[model samples]
Target: MDELIDHSFKLIAKILYFLVRIFAWLIFEFLYEEIAWWLGWCICRAITLNSRPTVGINGYDEATTTTRFVVCFTGIATIILAGTILAIYISANAT
Candidate 1:
């Protein structure tokens, strides 16, 4: 019985993880380009606000940085979110 319950929980966790990954991938695929461009532009503008000459960073560099940042941010967020949801589900279902 204990083994069964443990296996069931593991299955649930796996399903949740898979669903979250799919959702995150879909969102990233559809929005990363535009979001990266906007984020890069904003950061560049802020950095060059008081300077006479703009930085030499090109769009590709900005996009790369933005992509890294977004990926890290989303990865952390997804883990936290999934953990929270799993905790809540387990707590509610616990005896």
Candidate 2:
């Protein structure tokens, strides 16, 4: 009887693990796309805001514009990554 119970528990744990992985993937998939879009937007807005539409590859100023774009992109990516990790932790513990 003890062996049977252990086997059943293992099966349940496996199922739960698979479900949790799927849940995390679905959540992160949407977030990943949104982050890509935000990165693009960040690049565009930085250029527009500073009235500097020139790109580095196309004769734009190298130092200032690139610095601004990289800073904004990195900040946004870091925040989103931290949030996603927090969400995964919460999801695992909640179960």
Using lDDT, give the best candidate's number. 2
- Displacement of the residue 85 alpha carbon in candidate 1, Å: 33
TM-score of 1: 0.37
Give lDDT tens digits, candidate 2, residues 1-95: 99999999999999999999999998765454345334544555575784533334222234366554554465467678889999999999995
| Model 1, span 36-72: residue lDDT tens | 4444445545655834113233343434554556444
lDDT for model 2 comes to 0.61
Clashing pairs in 2: none
Evaluate residue 95 in candidate 2 and report its C-alpha lDDT on the 0 to 100 scale. Answer: 53
Please give each candidate's TM-score.
0.37, 0.44
Q: Which ten residues in a row have the lowest lDDT in candidate 1?
A: 51-60
